[model samples]
Target: MLIAVATYNEIDNLPIFVERLADTLPNVDLLVIDDGSPDGTGDWCLQEAKVNPHIHCLHRQGKPGLGSAIIAAMKYAVAHDYEVMVNLDADLSHPPEMIPLFLEAWEENDPGATVVIGSRYIKGGGIQGWPWKRHMMSKAINFYTRWLLWLPMADCSGSFRAYPVKLLKQVDFDSFLSQGYSFFEEILYHLKREGAQFVEVPFTFVERQYGASKISLQKAMVAVGTIFRLGMKVWFRA
Candidate 1:
């Protein structure tokens, strides 16, 4: 499996995050997609990639959104013949330790199972170090999405996930509309339509220890409208 992390101004977190990821999955390769960050995150990744053969970095000219970065990374994984791809936050919010469990779930699942999500709303899963407002916002977003789209997922908004490369290749990436957080749920909606089996593993999500969250109140409000538009599209397709 190839682990992919999209980074933008994550200089403080990348070094230690990559170190721990290497310790957790010694053999798996890592792909870091860095958007041009004035903080020199791309430079750091390039320096590390030179010494570590398992670490690969893709540099973008500017801060393209998360969806585009992941798409690019997935393409790289596919072109490189990787059978599985795991994506997590560049920040420490998504624990590197839970990576093994994601791989285990993907390996042990039925042949049709293609996406395994690290869920915070499931049993034994929750978030730590978040204020009550943020927690409620996350819960409400998940609930709203699940209810409107008739999604069976507990964490549709989470980015921590593992995907089978073959299954991902089947999706029309160019048609995906969202370029930010909305992509999380949109991808799952398409996967569900493709009859891809989904599995959720309980995992505690930690708040980012290094940088500030990219999510803004404006983005959150925009997401509500985006979700409704996406939901309508999904409903019509079904």
Candidate 2:
């Protein structure tokens, strides 16, 4: 398995996240895709990779967006012939300890689920530290995405997910329209078209303790537009 994290100016959180992940899953390889953070987050990852054979880093030019970073990681995983690729946030909001559950779910469902999501909207799942407005925005986004994209899962927007590399290799990353957070739903929509099966495992989402959120009103509007366009495609097909 290749565990990946996309980061930007997450120096304070990356170290703790890495340590916790390493403690939880020491045998897995970790890849850090950094967007040239001015705070030297890439530098720290490069330095850590030098000593830790299990750790790797890929430094990009600038803040390109989370979607591209994840797509890059997917290509890397395919090239390396990893069986599975797991992605989570670098801010520790997605707990590394829950990774084993994802893997277990993926295995138990052998030839059943192509993706396993760490869902916060299912039973036994919840969120902490987010304002009511943030919660409403999340709920609304998930509702619309599921309704429009025809995704059956309860959570469609979270980044904590495990994918089969074979299924990823079947996807054309270059064809993706979403270049930001909406990539999550966009990819799932495509994967669903490929007859992919999904499994949702419950997990709590804790707010980041360090660094600020990268979400913006502009990005949210873009996501809305992208999903709407995709939804229209679904409508036309139906």
Who wins the TM-score comparison? 2
How do all models score by TM-score?
0.96, 0.98
Clashes of 2: 0
| Per-residue alpha-carbon lDDT of candidate 2 for residues 1-238, written as tens digits (9 for 90 to 100) | 9999999999999999999998999889999999999999999999998999999999999788999999999999999999999999999899999999999999988543369999999999999999999999999999999999899999999999999988887888888898898999999999898878999999999999899999988899899999999999999999
lDDT for position 76 in model 2: 97
* Residue pairs whose backbone atoms clash in candidate 2: none
Q: How much lDDT does candidate 1 score?
A: 0.88
Q: Pairs clashing in candidate 1? A: none
User: Lowest summed lDDT over 10 consecutive residues: which window, candidate 2?
Assistant: 105-114
lDDT of 1 by residue, 1-238 (tens): 7999999899999999998998898888999999897899999999988999999999999767888899898889878888899999989999999988888898898634569999998999999999999999998999999987788988999999999988887888898877777888888887887888889999999899898788988878877787899889867877
Error of 1 at 179 (Å): 0.4
